[model samples]
Target chain A: MRVLLVDDERELISALAERLEMRGIQTRWVTSGRQAIEAMAQDCFDLAVLDVRMPGMGGLELKHRLAQSCPRMKFIFLTAYGSEQAFDSVATDMGDDFYLVKPVDIQELMAKINLLAGKEDA
Target chain B: MNPAPRSLTMDALQFSGTVTAAFSHDFKNTLAIIKENTGLLVDLLAMAEKGRPLDPQRLATLAERIGRQVQRADRMTAELNRFAHSADLPEAQTDLGAMLEMAVVLSARPANLKRVGLEAVTAPPLWIATFPFGLQQLLYRCIALLLDRAGSGGRIVLEADDGRPPVALRVIARTAEDRIPAGETAPTPTPEMTGLAHALQIRLDWDAAAGGWRLTWRDVET
Candidate 1:
């Protein structure tokens, strides 16, 4: 599956993209929401993984923008905040599931990705 | 007359929570980087088992990356530890430069998040005897207000001048976009800023040399 990862932390996102590519998934990464939008305009991707907090535009805001632009794209949020309670208190309407805490286990993340992406396959 | 900080428990808690949350997020990111690097090492080992030779140099590089992240985490914890103990004594001694530097360091994550640069440009070591926690809290609040208004690529400079008795701390901000350029009627101080300054018994005024606030306090024992 083709995926796009957006995170302000360059090293974390770069390493994640490399690992995903190793697993035979087409992956591209960017460090900002502006760049992410630019990239989406350049290519088509099945899913976008975004870190929930960023400098200029946060993940939820970017998600709303991306969803408006690319209706078919899927999203999975990544946050350093581990607890569900803390995530809920983020002062936003991002209450939907499919958000993962940081230091994410690859197997668990991959499982969630498959579950989200698999629905389209069927 | 000094206001009792015990009466400002709610304000103090909020101030502490703000710094703690920022530090927690930073620590998590540091840990996440370490984990990702370790995963790469394991992947390399797995590839070696699959008959592709794992260059020792690649393993060494990953190990080095992990080491740097660990050191970063260590420095963060030490900063947090010092901050946590700041409230231990209502009054404590601290170097003016050191105090300003700590405020700059602590506010860095939040400043970076807003695409603002927070820096300390101090003259030299100037010892001051004062309520350290209250002063620190005041500094953070002022920096935060600036960060909120700062646009992308803006810079805020913190400078300290010790006149021996009354020390002046200047917070000067230069925004990429033209913001209230230094003079012609400065914006009125926010109520929150006024309250924080009053509670800490420090004077907060507009510093129009370029743009920003000037914080002054008297230290008889300096």
Candidate 2:
């Protein structure tokens, strides 16, 4: 599956993309909301993993912007701030399908991705 | 006689909680990076065992990244420790530069989200016996006030006047749109805010020349 990772940390997102690529998933990464928009213009991804808080633009705002342009793209929200409770109150068109906190366990992430891919195929 | 006002207590709790939360958030970011880097190392090792030769440089870079994150986490821990200990005393001999530096660091994440560049331009160690925690809160609020005005590409500078007695501190949170004409009346701070400043014994004023808020005090505390 093709995926895009959006986060401010250069090291974290690049390493995440590399790790996912090793698992046979096509992954692209960007550091900011602006770059994410620029990337979507050039490439398509089946899934997006976004950091909830980032400089300039946050994940929620980016999600809306991305959703407007690419409605079918599935999303997973990651944050270091707090629990999924932080997102529970926000009215999101895309609910936290697989909300994960920081220091995410890769195995669980892989399972969630498989679940998403299966949903897409079905 | 009535007891002292509770604004200090409430304000202290609110500011302390905010700073601690930000520090915890920053630590999470650092830890997340370390976790991802280590996971990468594991992936590389597992692949190498399956006939893929390991790239020494790649492994070294991963190690370096992990080291850098560890250092980042360490600094955050030290800063948080200092911040927590700041409330231990109502008045203490505090270094103004360190105080400004902490304010800059704590305000950085939120300012970045607002796309406002926040910096602390501090000189030598200006020492004063004052309420460290309240001073930090005052500094934080001042910075936040300017960040409110500073839009994208706007810069806010927090600085203490160098080589000046009764060292004045300032937060330049004004955007270009904030400047007023000479004949026009400048905006005044709300009475409630002024009361809080009075409680903190900080002389707060709008410095048109600095295009932000200027704060000076006589090392006084209740």
Candidate 3:
């Protein structure tokens, strides 16, 4: 499945992208929401893995903006905060199924991504 | 009528929350990088077990990157710890330069978000007896305001002057055009700014000619 990853942490996103690619998932990554928007303008993806708190445009806000153009694209939010309150606040606005907290388990993340893309058995 | 002291308490709490949240986010990013690098190593080892040729050079690079991130996390935690303890003593003798340096570090996340570069100029040792936490809060607010006004791709230079009768700290916005446009007066201080200045017992004024804000306070070390 094709995926787009957006995060401000360069090292984290690069390593995660490499791992996802190694697992045979086509993935592209950008370091900021602005960059992700620019990339989306040039290409399309089936799903987006986004970090909730970014510098310029945070993940939630970015997702709202991206939805305007690519209504079919799915989203999975990644956050560093694992607190219930934090999750509940965002989950209430966005869905709870697609959220993962860091340091995320790669296997779990892969499974979630596959499930979100409707390729659960894969 | 003067606002209740509770309002000042709430302001301090808000300031603390803001700084802690910024530091926590930074720490999490650092940890995430380390986790990914280590995971990559594990993946590589698993591949090697399957007869895939493992590049020792790549492994070494990953190890080095992990080590670097660890050190970065250490520094961030240290700064956070120091900031947390800033309130330990309500009032104490404080090193002005050191306090400003810490303020710059704590203010970095917001400054970066605004695409503003922050630089603290070297200043000689200047000791002042004051409310350490209050001073930090005041400095943070001033820096935040300056960052907002700095616009995108701007730079701010922070300087501490020790020789002056009333020691002064200056926040200058580096821009092509002067921070204060011609014939226009300096912007009035917001209520938050006024309250913080009163609490800290410092004079915060706009230095229109210098294109910045100057915070002046008499050294309490008689």
Candidate 4:
């Protein structure tokens, strides 16, 4: 499946992308929301994994824009904040079951991706 | 009649508290990143246990990055510790260069977040008998404001000089709001700025023509 990664933290984003690529997934990575929007204009991806607290354009705002542009593209938010309060607020707005915090087990993430991506395959 | 010292003392306390809270929040976030990195390593190990091959090179790099972050986190903690204890404190001999280095590191994260490069012009460690904590607080708040206003790919320069008879540190500004041309008296210190300067026994000058502000400690008796 194709994945798009967005994060201002270069190290984390690069590492995550490398890991995901190793798992046999096609991935494209961008550091900012603007870049992510531009990438979407150029090509479509199955999922967009975003960091929540990027500087200029935050993740939730980016999600809103992406939802409008690419309705079919799924989203998974990766944040350092583990508070339930933060999660609940984002979950209501995102309307998806794929919000995961940082340090998420790769296997669990893969399982969730398989489950979501399988909607088309099934 | 001398202005009541209590009011100045209270203001200093409040300023220190805000600074400490901000610094601690930053430190906490750094720790959180390190925690996440370690957790990722653990996941990689678990994957190896499950008969999946993991890249040794990536693991090594990740380990190195975590170590660097730990040292970064340690330095931030030390700054926070010193700042927290320096409430309405008297003047003491301080290494101006080291203090600026700490502030630069603390400010760099925000600058990097805003895509700004925070740079400091280093001089030899000039001995200044000043309340270093107050100076740090003043500098931190100003840099934070500048970084917030500075757009992506902007640059902020922090320089120290021995020219003011008493040591002086000037923060070179970037944004239109921060620009202060040189050789001019600094604008009146805001009440907040004045209060902080009062606590540190330093004088703050706003130089509009030079496009920056200067803090000097000339009056404090050694």
lDDT of 3 at A53: 81
Q: TM-score, each model?
A: 0.91, 0.90, 0.89, 0.72
User: What does DockQ give for each predicted structure?
Assistant: 0.76, 0.81, 0.58, 0.22
The 10-residue segment with the lowest total lDDT in model 4 chain A: A81-90
Model 1 accuracy (lDDT, Cα): 0.80
lDDT score for residue B89 of model 4:
57
Candidate 1 CAPRI classification by DockQ:
medium
State the lDDT of candidate 3 residue by residue for B1-222, as single tens digits.
Answer: 865454777889999998998888788788889999999999889889999999999999999999999999999989989998889987788888898898889899988777787888878878787788888888887777666566677767788876457778897776534343245456666677788787777889899777688988844432
**Model 1 spans with C-alpha error above 4 angstroms:** A95-97, B1-7, B162-164, B177-192, B219-221
- lDDT digits (tens) for residues B1-222 of candidate 4: 645445655655765665554565455456545665676687689889999999999799889988987887788777766655554456677778777876786566566657777778888767767676667767876676556444575667788885446677877666434443334443444566777776676777765654566777756432
Residue-level lDDT for B133 in candidate 1: 80
lDDT of 2 by residue, B125-217 (tens): 888777787787877777777665677777788888873666678888645354422332334664445666786677899887666888887
Off by over 4 Å in 2: A85-96, B1-6, B163-165, B174-193, B218-222
Q: What's the lDDT for residue B113 in model 3?
A: 74
Error of 2 at B185 (Å): 8.6
* Model 2 vs. true fold: TM: 0.90
Compute fnat per model.
0.64, 0.88, 0.46, 0.12
